[model samples]
Target: MQEILVLYYSHRGSVRALAEMIAQGIDSVPGAAARLRTVPRISAVCEATEPDIPSTGAPYAETQDLEECIGLALGSPTRFGNMAAPMKYFLDNTAGPWLSGALAGKPACVFTSTASQHGGQESTLLSMMTPLLHHGMLLVGLPFSEPDLTRTRSGGSPYGATHWAGKDDNIQLTDEEKRLATALGKRLAETALKLHAR
Candidate 1:
């Protein structure tokens, strides 16, 4: 099966929910599967360390995951109009893969969750795209043709998928949000398959 890495850092479970939805879409495609992985949280104290294995949720991602996957779906919660630090830290450590061009020509999509509707979801998605672009990955985004993109009352975008988790981060994803995210994932997987065929 062709594997698409669903890599994300979800603090309050909202982004995780979106990740799973995207994975579902990826898995819906024949011959494509989702590899769910996450990065460890960064510590402010220099001496603090995280366990090698997380206590819950997906395992910590490795560089090998990037090497192994045919496509990528990157997600993170918004942190002041940018990706969260852990996800950024993980990408910062990807110089090895970048220098080797391991992700070149591979398809990629990005997703984000925000505390408020204006909490910088698009900027966060755009921020995540920078590293993927640097690694030469092809970007896949939801198009206007997706009906949900035109009508989402909560979270969806042409740049990628997004969720408005509210100030308390307790809001469930709207039906439109779910549909658009799934569409984005399907598009990424299909794009990867086509690129591999070339």
Candidate 2:
């Protein structure tokens, strides 16, 4: 099976919800599977460290996961118009992959959740794409052709998928948001398959 790594850092579960939907879409494609992984929270204290295995949710992602996957779906909650620190921390350490060009030509998509409708979802998605671009990964985004993209009143974007989690972060994803997220995943998987076939 071809694996597409669904890598994310979710704090309030909003991003996690989106990640699950995306994984479902990836799995829907025959011969393509989702490898869900997450990174641990980073501590401000320089000496602090997280456990090797997380207490719940996905396992902490290793560099090997990047090497094994044919495609990538990166997600994170917005932090001041940018990706959360934990996800950024993980990507900051990907110099090894960058040097080896391990992710070159692999298809990638980004997703994000925000506390408000204007909580910088697009900026966060764009921020996350920077590292993937540096790795030479091809970006896949929601196109206007997706009906949900034109209809979504809550969370969806041409840049990628997004969720408006509300200030309390308790709002459920709208139907349109779910459909768009799933479509983005399927698109990434299909793109990866086509590229891999070459």
Candidate 3:
């Protein structure tokens, strides 16, 4: 089966919740599966290090995860209109994969959760796409065809799936947000499967 990497960084757990929904979407594809991974928190001190494995949630992501997956779904909480430091830090280390074209031609999608409606959900999603683009992965966004994109008042975007977690970071994923995230995962996996079949 083809694996779609569901990679994310979630400090408040909102983005991780979104990642799980996306993974469900990926797993729904008949011949595809989800490889869930998360990055370690970045210590402000340069020399500090995280344990080799996290205490809970998905394991820390490795460079091999990028090369092995047929598709990718990247997620993060909005960090001042950008991806969180840990996710960015992990992507920054993929130079070897970039040099080898290990991720070239793979289908990819992005997702994020922001603290408020006007928070940088779309920008964070767009920023997450940069590294995937650099790696030559095909970008996939939630199209207008997904009815939720037209009806969602909370957090669905054509750029990708997103959620508004509120100020306390307590808002749960709405049904629409969940549906769109799953759709993105399915779309990415289906696209990757077709591309690999060729």
Candidate 4:
């Protein structure tokens, strides 16, 4: 089976939820499976470290995960119009993969969640894409042809899937948001399959 790594960091569970939805969509493709992984929180204190295995949720991701996946779906919660530090921390350590061009030509998509409707979801998604682009991966985004993109009143975007978690981070994803996230995942898997066939 072809694997698409679903890598993400979630503080309030919003981005994690979106990642799972995307994973489900990826697995819906006959030959594709989702490999769910997460990064541990980074500490500001000097030389602090997280446990090797997380207490809950997905385990920490390794560089090999990026190299082995047929495609990638990266997700993170917004931190001041950017990706959260934990996800960024993980991506920052991939210099070896970058040097080896391990991710070159692989299809990649991004997703994000925000605390409010205007909480920089699109910007966060764009920021996440920067690294994938640097790795020479092909970007896959939701197109206007997806009915939910035109109709969504919540977190769906042409750039990627998103969720508005509200100030308290309590809001549930809208139906439109869910559909768009699934659509994005399926699109990524399909594109990856086509590229791999070549």
Candidate 5:
């Protein structure tokens, strides 16, 4: 099976929910598997560190994960119209992959969760794509062909899948958001398969 990396950092459960749904979609593809990974929270104190294994969630990602995966699904919580600091910090440390062109020509997609309806989901997705582009990865996005792209009043976009978790991060992903996120994953996996085949 070809593995697609579902790498993310979730401050709350919202982004993790979307990542899970996306993983389900990825696994639905015949020869695709989702390798779930997460990063530790960035500490405010320079001396602080997180355990190698997270207490309750996905294992911490290493650059080896990026090199081995056939494709990538990047997710993060929105932070002032940008990706959260932890996700950004992890991406910033990928110099080895960047130097070796490890992710070149790979398929990639992005997702994000935000605290409000206008919490900049699109911007966060775009910001996450910047480094992937530098790595020469091909980007995949939802198109109008997916009915959910038009029907999702909550968190679907042509840019990528998204979720509005409300001001307190209490909202669940709407059905439309779920379908769209799944569709985005399937699309990503299918695209990765075709590219890897070449």
Candidate 6:
């Protein structure tokens, strides 16, 4: 099976929900598999403060995951229109892959969740793309051709996928949000398969 990494840092389960939907889409492709991984929470006091393994949800991501996956789906919650610190901290430490071009030519997608409709979802998604661009990865994003992208009232975007979690972060994903996320993943997996064919 070809493994596509679904790497994310979800603060209040909203991003994690999106990641699961994306993984579902990836798993729908025959010969494609979703490899779910997550990074540890950052600590202010010291480095390597988080345990090597998390207590729940996906395991902590390793640089090796980036090297091994055929494609990548990156997701994180928005923090002041940027990716959360933990995710950024993890990306900042990817010098090994950056130097070796381990992710070069691989297909990638981005996703984000926000506390409100205007809570910097697009900016967060764009920010996540910066490093992948530097790594020479091929960005795969949703298109307006997806009906949901044109009509979704909640969290769907051409840049990738998004969710509006509301002020309390209690809102469940709307159907449109779910479908678009799945579409993004399916699109990404198909692209990875085509590239891997070469």
Per residue, candidate 4 scores C-alpha lDDT tens digits across 113-172 of: 998799899999999999999999999999999998888877988889999888889647
Off by over 4 Å in 5: none
Listed in order, each prediction's TM-score against the native is 0.98, 0.97, 0.97, 0.97, 0.97, 0.97
| Tens digits of lDDT, candidate 5, 108-132 | 9999998888989999999999999
Better of 2 and 6 by lDDT: 6
The candidates, ranked best first by lDDT, are 6, 1, 2, 5, 4, 3
Candidate 6 per-residue C-alpha lDDT over 1-198 given as tens digits, one digit per residue, 9 for 90 to 100: 999999999888999999999999999999999999998888788655877788888998999999999999999999999999999999999999999999999999999999989989999999999999999999999989999888888899899999999898964899999999999999999999999999
Off by over 4 Å in 6: none
Better of 1 and 6 by TM-score: 1
Q: C-alpha displacement of 184 in model 3, angstroms?
A: 0.8
Candidate 6 structure lDDT:
0.94
Candidate 5: pairs in clash: none
Give one digit per residue, the lDDT tens place, for model 3 in 21-122.
899988999999999999999989989988999999999889999888888999999889999998898899999999999999989999999988998888
**Each model's C-alpha lDDT?**
0.94, 0.94, 0.91, 0.92, 0.93, 0.94
Candidate 1 per-residue lDDT over residues 1-198, each given as its tens digit? 999999999999999999999999999999899999999989999998889999998999999999999999999999999999999999999999999999999999999999899989999999999999999999999999999988987899899999998878974889999999899899999998889889
As a TM-score, model 1 comes out at 0.98
The candidate, 1 or 3, that scores higher on lDDT is 1
The 10-residue segment of model 4 with minimum total lDDT is 166-175
Regions more than 4 Å wrong, model 2: none
Clashing pairs in 3: none
